[model samples]
Target: MISTAIHCGACGARMEPGANYCSNCATGRDDPNTRALFVVDGTTGLFNDAFTGALVDHETSRAMRYKRPISVLVAMLDHSEFIANDHGPAQSADLLRELAEVLAGAVRDIDTVGYLGDRFCMVLPETDQAGAMVAADKVMHAVAAHQYAAGHGQWERITLSLGLATVNPDRMGRQDLIQSATLALMDGRSDGSNKVHLVSQMS
Candidate 1:
């Protein structure tokens, strides 16, 4: 597949029935093979950017309509450049794949985890700011507890930083939520990696 976007009408993230994509994705909308390739990141088996964005937007709209809390978290593997430099770009990608599994395991089943191009994003439904922090801690601890095989049977522990944003119906939209999470991620990274930041903490 050439990696072109194919969004579905039902949810905007295109997929076919029984495909290895998100639950709402496989709405029997697009060709199975094409949908799978378009929606999934081949390396990590997570939703690709186009599909993830749709999921985010969908969740945001739902949260807004129902007056329920929803949180979005943006995370990045700390010192990824160092990992790439020390090992190779492939190794860095492998580490990311491993991290993706950890993230999948750490969050609730209802939560959606995806690769948003350069970073991993988690969309948490019914999760407010406090719940988001708890989820982030689970992810951080889960990652810290696991070790990745760097090379030559060498096990290396990896870490990450997370930024969180909860939808504020009064003032926040999808873009605002994403930007807040990105800013929070930046704040945590600036203070030194392995931290979780919130937009409210921004000085």
Candidate 2:
């Protein structure tokens, strides 16, 4: 008899003989849903947090070495918690996934998009503050115009609260850049949702 035992290609976990899937990692040879081991979010198919951080660090180092400008944008879905409570978690996840696609399509080829916790972040390479603002505006309009699944055979409009921070590699770390964008996002949220806030010049 052909043995069903195998190792998970994604996670390297052993699978029992006759088992259809790897018990440890849930990967199967024939499973169509199996994704790459890391670097991808299971839900949205965007880069995961760890991989995102690594990319940010690498980009920051390159920017510092070359003295180029870079910008990061942190965007949060407005009323996302309420959407989850009202429409259910599954629908909320669906909305997030769709939004991820929209974000991916809205950015330039050199830009990177990833999910960072409850928010989504974009890294704009070789972009200064003005260029980042233009990109942010494009994303804002795209998100606001897209229709999201609202459950029960209805669609709803979605808005994002976005924060932008630009760096010229003037002694700023990746974490500091992220934190600056996050602080701007918080300020936007405080003012009300569906708005973009730029990091203060003094920051």
Candidate 3:
């Protein structure tokens, strides 16, 4: 009989054994085989230069090593499209960072946000599809009302393409998890902008 004793990362309290997750703080059971949820694959020098480097270190060293199932939120800023059409890059970049920071504040400290290629990856630990949706909404809302202060001589607004997906180690591996979420993002973006589409996978 494998007794899985769940424990909260925030506070050392014995969680209800075999619980879906830690009810108190949503800490998931420690399993060495669950897939990762977050996938941010973006180009360099968009959000921050250190984003991708930091992401790789964290994923390989901490996330993958622990075997915790991951949930991912990807935010892609189409600056090139805007620039080609004679739009402001500075204003757009600022808005993107603001949205990313908002998402960072919304998740638990244990969770991580990293750069994957040109996109930003939000690693949600033990969070399900529903919870990820709520978190994504928080970011969307935060970005929506964020004014770029027109009087400050700024273009003052930017659009984003976002997607959400969860990684279940019991079902997927590293490459597959990334592929699943990436496909979802593409599908969502194909539909329209400013959308948060949930991946068709178990959260």
Candidate 4:
């Protein structure tokens, strides 16, 4: 029996696990359409408050609520830089699919993948920042190993940058989660290639 409670994102009211409706706003407990926000810069997407909310909703509905803190990892693939001098989206379908496969292999069956524009998001349920880093390292290694199909009948090896941050109900909302990840990703891109940035962790 869980005793902790979270606030209704739509309305500032306390909500407990198994809550199907917001007592203050009368909003449906789990709104699937209220999705997580992603700031995609090329192939990178930052998970924010919207994403956290959705996870909370889904987990509560299914009765598999996450008791431990969790984090979000955002990775983007730059189109122009992906094929160096080719001004287009990354078109290495085989390589991208392979990378995704490799990453999926590393995660638990409960975790899920989402398409946020050109970027992809991996929802790490019940995972903390450190655990996410391990998964990110696996993904980075797998992606770095790929020989992507560059434009104009050429092959190229690409790189990736990642941002990681944990979800905190008190200190953040859905949008804040996205913002933290985005800021971390931007900082990483500025720092150098093939780096993972850990922005925040539950205290």
Candidate 5:
């Protein structure tokens, strides 16, 4: 008969036969695949789309269960596509990385920051619409104030268009919240980027 016993992938502890995870180290047997589920974006070291969606789902459920306010912020670089077209993908990606760093610095430690494609998303737990607006304003100001180091000793300025959506008495799904924020972001872009739009104010 073939042996089924294996070692823990994380701690190298011996695992019992037919075990799904290690008893001694508590490491999962299928950790390689499991870890892939939470992989970060290689460029920015932020949560990728799959992980971001999962996080949003988890946070939304928690907020609904606990009656806590949760806010989602979606931010896009102003004229990012234009930048890519004019400056090339390398410069555009560098700008994204710099902006990601600024965003990571702007939010509270409790907040979750992730990337949804080229756009940035932040999930703020226990935050209402007002609080989210404040956070959004801070991020906008920070990005506006930051000077990115362009190539050849030249500096460049970057701006963000942000959208914020908060949980309310009417329950909303994770995707719905994201969509609302996206719509608000689009509105901000239409009004000219470097602005923050609140979904609550849209209606």
Candidate 6:
């Protein structure tokens, strides 16, 4: 689907990926709302936490209004601490940016993906538990397929331990759903890496 994430200031045209100016009118985007709509990595550009949270809030409301399912996925790199300690924070942070890019490419433009605290989170609107699992699996596969610089010019593979939670809007709020997925991810990581764990509404 075409993403209506941001629009041109001059002509109200939709901004395309990797665009700094409007393709139709070449208008410069200085609008705060435009920045909020574009998701970027922390080190690279503007990463808006409030925007992600607000998107979740809107999605939750939409799900409730439509009686649909919404799923949240929380994922972290396996041995992340070790990577930071061994290779330094810069490398680890770079990997995270790469992870975010991979995740951005893996899902639809409508989906929200960004750093929620230290871990990465994806909010999938109208996605049920099954769809969330599939997305999580795709992420794991994407991580496996991409190689990262391990420092000293050596490249290595990394894995993700992901947690997925799905619920109808009537069951939980945005934060609650994210927390459920995060807790599930913690549990799954304890068992093994490169795995996707699923959870439903709390209690």
In order, candidate lDDTs are 0.76, 0.78, 0.55, 0.56, 0.76, 0.70
Q: Could you tally the backbone clashes for each prediction? A: 0, 0, 16, 11, 0, 0
Q: What are the per-residue Cα lDDT tens digits for candidate 4 across 39-76?
A: 21223222223443465445433322334555667777
Listing every candidate in turn, what is its Cα RMSD in Å to the true structure after a full C-alpha superposition?
A: 7.1, 9.6, 9.7, 9.1, 7.7, 6.4
Model 6 weakest 10-residue run by lDDT: 32-41
Model 3, stretches more than 4 Å misplaced? 1-68, 78-80, 83-96, 149-155, 169-176
RMSD of 4: 9.1
At residue 54, give the lDDT of candidate 4.
63
Off by over 4 Å in 5: 1-38, 151-155, 169-175, 201-203
Better-scoring candidate (TM-score), 5 or 6: 5
Shift in Å, residue 65, candidate 3: 8.8
Query: lDDT score, residue 3, model 6?
Result: 55
Worst 10 contiguous positions by lDDT, candidate 4: 39-48
Alpha-carbon lDDT of model 2: 0.78
**Residue-level lDDT tens digits of model 5 in 1-203:** 99765877766766657866443323467773343433478777677776676667766787887777888999988877667777787776777787788899999867878888868999887888889989999999998888887521333777889889888535544445777898988866778878888885422
lDDT, model 1: 0.76
Task: Please report the TM-score between candidate 2 and the true structure.
Answer: 0.77
TM-score of each: 0.79, 0.77, 0.56, 0.57, 0.76, 0.75
Candidate 2: which stretches are off by over 4 Å?
1-35, 150-155, 169-175
- Tens digits of per-residue lDDT, candidate 1, 136-169, equal 9999999988877643233378788898988755
- Residues 95-165 of candidate 2: C-alpha lDDT, one tens digit per residue: 88999999999999668898886889898889888899999999999998887664334447888999988
By summed lDDT, the worst window of 10 consecutive residues in model 1 runs over 25-34
lDDT computed for candidate 5:
0.76
Tell me the tens digit of each residue's lDDT in model 6 across 1-203: 98559877766767756667543333457752444334444663324455556556666776877878888888888887777777787776676776677777887755767676578888888887778788888888988887665433443777888888887645654456777888888876778888998874443
**Most lDDT-accurate candidate:** 2
Better of 2 and 4 by TM-score: 2
